[model samples]
Target: MLLNNLNNDQGFRNFYMNKRGPIINHLCFDDDVILFSSGNRKSLKRIMRTLKTYEDVSGQLVNKHKSSVILHDKACARRIDRAKRITTMKQECFPINYLGCPLYLGRKRISTFSVTVQKILNKIRGWFFKFLSVGGKSVLIKHVLQAMPSHLLAVMQPPKTVFEIIENAFNRFLWSGSDGNKKLHWSSWDNLSYPINDGGANFRKLADISKAFTTKHWWKLRTKRYLWSLFLNTKYCSRIHPVTNKWRNGQSHNWKAMCSIKVLVENNLGWIIEKGEVAFWYDNWTDLGPLYKFLDPDSKPSKLRITDAYQNGHWNWPACGYVVSDFIKAHIERMQVVLSDKPDLPIWKITSSGKFNIESAWNFLRNSRHESNIVNALCHKAVPFKMSFMAWRVFHRKIPSNDIIISWFKLLASPNCTCCRVSQPENIDHIFFQSYVASSA
Candidate 1:
């Protein structure tokens, strides 16, 4: 029975014992054993008797070590010892030179391990050169050859630095873009135009070459070559603008426009104009209050001041209030006709009513009647309550009426109602209800 199947049988040992015969020499279940002798019937009977006697006295079978075998031979043992000695000798003589150093391999007589190491180093060097392309291949090749050892001639050799490898690779192809013998034409004023015997011919030659290389014609011819080299070598060259002292191909139109405005103001009006005025004048010619102030403040009948509010906040403009007042007054006076006509327009329909002043009209439209009442009635409401009220009072210049306040609250309480939707949203409410009607009507 298979070892795994033995678990099902209760008397597996007894079953095996029943099957024992003359041909069977031994039986073992783990460490326990039974031995049989089958040389002759007489010897077998003697062995069986000894086994039975042993079972009765000690309850164990005969040990094979203590039992004698009739056919023990010396020749088989001698042959096995000789075969083991031969195998050991062959193992000792196995070739180790076949697996050389891994650093240098494939090109010369370096070890395999040395060849592999060299290959790895080459890869690293190549990556470095890919970023820093500066020199020629010959320079790198010379340095590498000098560094390489003399002994590694068969297995492999180290490659030159990445720079050299790339140079050599491109050198193999004849690039049409590369200049062969086309000499740059030197002008008569160039130093190189005269012979070296002349006093400044050498200096002239240097200057001429520099100018030729920098000139439009020569540059056009070499542009492709120079760009190609730059791409392959991963090197970049840059030029700077003379006037701006910045690296750029073209001037900023914004700066140019500003300069032009400054020049025009200085030449025509004898004034120093601000950048804002320049921009404003450029956008709309009639909107020239600031420009007029900059040009001839004395000539203008109205007092005018120009203030930068943000700059004043930072203490950048000291007389900001005066400037702002003057600038605003001047701006209004300049557009006096337009301002006077504004009231006649539909936009000032509320002002045309003559009941409420401009400030009152602004206040009435600024806050929803409901929101204002909610804040006034409930002191427990958030701080935004007092803040909103204060802002309206300070900016709009009037307290809201109770009717307007109650209507605002009703609108807020309504659900999905048109009056609520139109009036409840505060900014939209202020715009359509107040500002838009006043400005457009």
Candidate 2:
């Protein structure tokens, strides 16, 4: 009903996309109602009148005192005052939290997203991790600490320092004892973040997770026609191509940060050009990258689409005069080009399923190029968590081992091997194997 009245009002104008399609001015999900309009006296009056009408017809009164007006444009101070006077509601400032997310007119600041960090810290500080076993603590780290930032990361990209802070807190929680005394970290965070199959603790890396999520969001923007996607496309990415466009620093920090993962996405993003509509020079349809890059410099760039290689939904070999090399010929022949009537499908290359999901993205980001089997015993499922952790320490040469405890961390007083009652240096080798008592055992 409010929409109807607002639509009829000649003076009212809602935000439009590309100056072509009309965007809805009001959005109501459950009890949360958000009304948006141009910052003008006429538009504001129309909105207020529509709300008043809705109240009268529905027998529900809007609490004007609770509802505050926020103006995006500071230049419209007079108009803002008029709206405030007409509605008898207070005018709120920008950078205020709306439904747990910070809303502001300009670039995002680290300070704006500090709430998420504080929330995570508060949760960690209150937890009784002392009673939990290593396995239980690992579960908490994965499900609780890692999950805390997901909701925020889904919508916006926090600063790099934010992730560093988060990871530091995680490190303390994992390594510190129940009494809060610091213990030696078994492995570097990078090594511990690898997959279980690859001999890691399977812990997620903060920076990588953030990048994967942001990249996944970018994928959605390309494939999905959401209102936010449409708005962003019409506003920011209208002139820029997805693969080649560089994110400018002056743009919205949220978008700039999101687009920062474009290179990673491009490296892994593949397409099934069923209709052959892909751009021959730019699109990643072939495994060898853009065909233009492989071509001789003397060869003039052709305006040929991939469709030119086909005639009546069948591969036309004679028409592909551009294919000069025997390798190109074999590559094309090997390609199962069943030209379907359906549009092309974009896929994530790292995943076996070929769909872009957060889990797959995270896995791609955390995957190590070098595979090692030496740590497999340490990460084996049969091993207890504390033993596995200890094994990790031994693998990384981080065990306290008397001398290290005495010298490096300065927690212990003596360097003698206590188990063997010998003056020999109590290094890892001596404590575990070389000592008299250890050898006897």
For residue 67, model 1's alpha carbon misses the true position, in angstroms, by 46
lDDT by residue (tens digit), candidate 1, 1-441? 222232243432221222221123455657654343323334444444445666678776555443333222333554434433422211111112232323211232323234434553564345332322212322233244312322222222223333234333222211112223222221122221232222111111221221222222211211224532333222112221111122233433222222322322222121122322212211122234233344334332222122232232232233332233466445634542211111111111233452323243223222222334333433223434334334333333233333344454564342222433344322433544554453466
Specify the poorest-scoring 10-residue window by lDDT in model 1.
Answer: 338-347
lDDT of 2 at 285: 81
Off by over 4 Å in 2: 1-9, 20-24, 27-30, 52-66, 105-107, 128-133, 181-191, 197-199, 275-280, 291-341, 367-372, 406-414, 421-423, 436-441
Cα displacement (Å) at residue 15, model 1: 64
- The prediction achieving the highest TM-score against the true structure is 2
Q: 284-381, model 2: which lDDT tens digit per residue? A: 78777666567776664454567886676566655654664678667866886777778888888888888888888877666574545767866687
